[model samples]
Target chain A: MKITIQVMVPPYSYEDLDTAIKIAEAALDKGHEVTIFLFSDSVLAVNKLVKPVKADRNIPEKLSQLIKEKGLRVEICGICMDYRGVNTDMIIEGSNPSGLPELAELIYTSDRFINLMA
Target chain B: MEKKVLFVAYQSPVGSVWPNEVFRTAFGMYGEDIEPAVLFLDEACVTVSKNTKPELLGLFPLTTCHRLIKRYGTPVYVVKEDLERYNVKEMEEIFNPQILSRVELSDFLHQFDLVIFM
Candidate 1:
C-alpha cells in the first residue's frame, strides 16, 4: 500500500521526534510505500539548526539519512516553513520544500493517509 | 466531485480554539461535496464527552461535534483506547458513539481520499 503521512507536530523534544520516526520506520518496514509531508510546527523536524543536544538518537540526521537511503519523499510545508522563519539552507539535506497543493495531491493519490500531530 | 475526507482532531477543544476553527473551515469548504468522517484521538476525544459544558467557557459551547456533523450526515468515530485512557467510558453510555480500535482506524484510513489532521 502507498502511505502518505502528514506530521504537523514540531519535534521540539525527543519524545515527539522519536514517535514520528518510529511511525515512519514501522510503515516502511511493513512493506508500504511511504511519503512524509511535514507541516505546521512539524517542519522543525527537518531544521538543521535544531541539533539533538543530549540524545544519542539524532532524529533529524537519522531522518535525513533515511530519506536518502530509502528514497523516502520528505516534503516540508513551504508556507509553514516561512511562517516559522525556517530558511532553505537550514533544512536538512535531501528534504524538499512543498506547499498545500502537493499535500492535497499526495492525499488524493495515496492508499492511506496518516496524520501525526503534537 | 464527492470525495471521502477523514478529519482527525488530536487536540483538546477547550483550551484551544483550533479544533472548532479547523472543523468549521473544512465543513464550509467541503461539506456539500464530500463525505466527511471524523476521528477523535488522544486529547481530542474530550471534545465529544457528554459531560463537557462548553457554555461556561463563554465561547460558542458547541461540544457535540458528532451531533453537529451527523446532522449533515457525517460519520464520527472516537478512538476506544483514548476514551479508556481518559476514563471517559461514561461518554459512550450517554452518546452511543462508534468505538474504533487501532486496527479499525488503520482500515478507515484506507477508505479515505484525503485525511486532514488538526
Candidate 2:
C-alpha cells in the first residue's frame, strides 16, 4: 500500500507524533510504501537544532534514519516551518520543503491516508 | 462494509474545544453508513461523566449525547485508569461506556480502520 501519514503535533508535547513515526516504520516493515508529511507543530519534529528531553524519543534523528536507512519519503510543510521560525538549515537532512499542493496530490494518490494529530 | 472510525477524545472540557467537536462530529455521522466508536481517554473521561453539563456554557447538552447513543447505538469506551484517577462517579447515565485498561485500550485502538484523536 502507498500510505501517507501526516503528523500535526509537536514531539515533546505528546506521544501521538512519535507514535505516527513508529506506525510509518511498521508499515514499511510490512512492505508498504510510506510517505510522511509534517504539518503545524509537527514541523518541529524535523528541526535538527531542537534538542528533546532525554526521556523523550529523538524525533529528528529518527526521522533522518527513516529517510536515509528505510528510504521513507518525508515532507515538511514550508508555511508551517516558516511560521515557527524554522529555517531550511534547521530541518532534518533529506526532508523536502513541501506546500499544500503536494499534500493534496498525496491525498489523491495514496492508497491509505492517515493523519496522526493530537 | 462501513468504514470503522474510532474517535479518541482525550481532551478535557476545561476551555478545550475537543469534547464539543468530537461529540458533534460523532453525532453528525450517526445516520451515515460509517461505524463510529468513541473512546474517552485521559481528561476526556469527564465528557461522558453524568455530572458534566456543558449546556451551562451554551455548549451542547449532555442529554443530546445520551440521545445520540440511544438512537444511533454508538459504542462508547473509556480508559479505566483515567476514569479511576479522576474519581468519576454516577457513571450509569453517561452512555454506559465500556471500560478498558491502558494496554487494553491500546489494543482496542488497532481494531478501527481510522483513528482520530481530539
Candidate 3:
C-alpha cells in the first residue's frame, strides 16, 4: 500500500515530525511505500543549514538519511518554500521540490494519508 | 477506489490562514481520484454562515472554492452545536450540507481513510 504522510510544522517545532518518522519507519517495515509531503513551515525540514549540537538530535540529517536508506520519497511544497524563501539549492539532496498538483496525485494514489500538523 | 480525506476545521478564519488553506488544498486536489470533504467545527462554522465572504477580507478566494465545491459536488459537514455556538444561521453556497449532531459526527468521521485537522 502507498501511504502519504504530510508534515506541516517546522522540524523540532513539535513532536509531529518525529512521530511522522516513526510512523514511516513502521509503515516501511511492513512493506508499504511511503511518501513524505512537506508543506508550510515543515519545508524547513529539508534545509541543509539546520545545525544542532552534538547532544541534540540532528533532525534534518535524520530526514535525509531516511530518504537515502529507507527509499522514502520526500516532496517539499514549492509555494510554501517561496513563502519562507527556501530555494532548491538550500534543501537536502534527496528530496524533490513540488506543488499542490503533486499533493493531489499522492492523496489520490495513496491508500492512506496521515497529516502531521497542529 | 480513491482514498477518502476529511478536512476537520476547528479554527476561525479571523487573522488565520489555516481555514482557507484547507479550501485551497481541496480545490487543488478535487476532480482527481480523491474524495475530499470539509467538516466545519468549533469557530470554523462561522465561515460557512450565510453572506460572510472570507475572500473579501483578502483571505484565500473562497468564491473559487465555492465554485469547485458546487462543480464537483464535494461533501460538506457541520456540527449542529457548532452552528448554534457560532450563531451561524445557515451554511450557504453549499448544496445539501450534512448537519450532524456531535454523536452522529463522531461515528460518521471514521468512514474516511484520512483526517486532516486545522
Best by DockQ: 3
Tens-place lDDT per residue, model 2, B1-118, is 4667777778886556566556655665544456778888888898877778777888656676677678877788888889889988768464878889998866798888778785
- Candidate 1 lDDT by residue in tens digits, B1-118: 5668777777787776556644553454341445666777788787668776667878656545445565554556788889888777456333345888877877878897766777
lDDT of 3 by residue, B1-118 (tens): 7777888778886666676777778767765777888887888777677666766776665566677677777677888988887788866856457788988976788998878886
lDDT of 2 by residue, A1-118 (tens): 8999977777888886678888999999999999998877788888888776789678889989999988899988887788799989888889999876676566556779787765
Interface RMSD of each: 5.0, 8.1, 1.6
Clash pairs, candidate 1, are none
Candidate 3 stretches greater than 4 Å from native = B51-61, B94-96
Q: By DockQ thresholds, what CAPRI class is model 2?
A: incorrect
Quick one: ranking by TM-score, best first?
A: 3, 1, 2
TM-score of each: 0.58, 0.52, 0.86
Candidate 3 overall Cα lDDT vs. reference? 0.82
**Each candidate's DockQ:** 0.16, 0.10, 0.66
Instruction: Write the candidate numbers in order of decreasing lDDT.
Output: 3, 2, 1
List per-prediction Cα lDDT, in the order shown: 0.71, 0.78, 0.82
Q: What is the DockQ of candidate 2?
A: 0.10
Shift of residue B66 alpha carbon in model 2, Å: 2.3
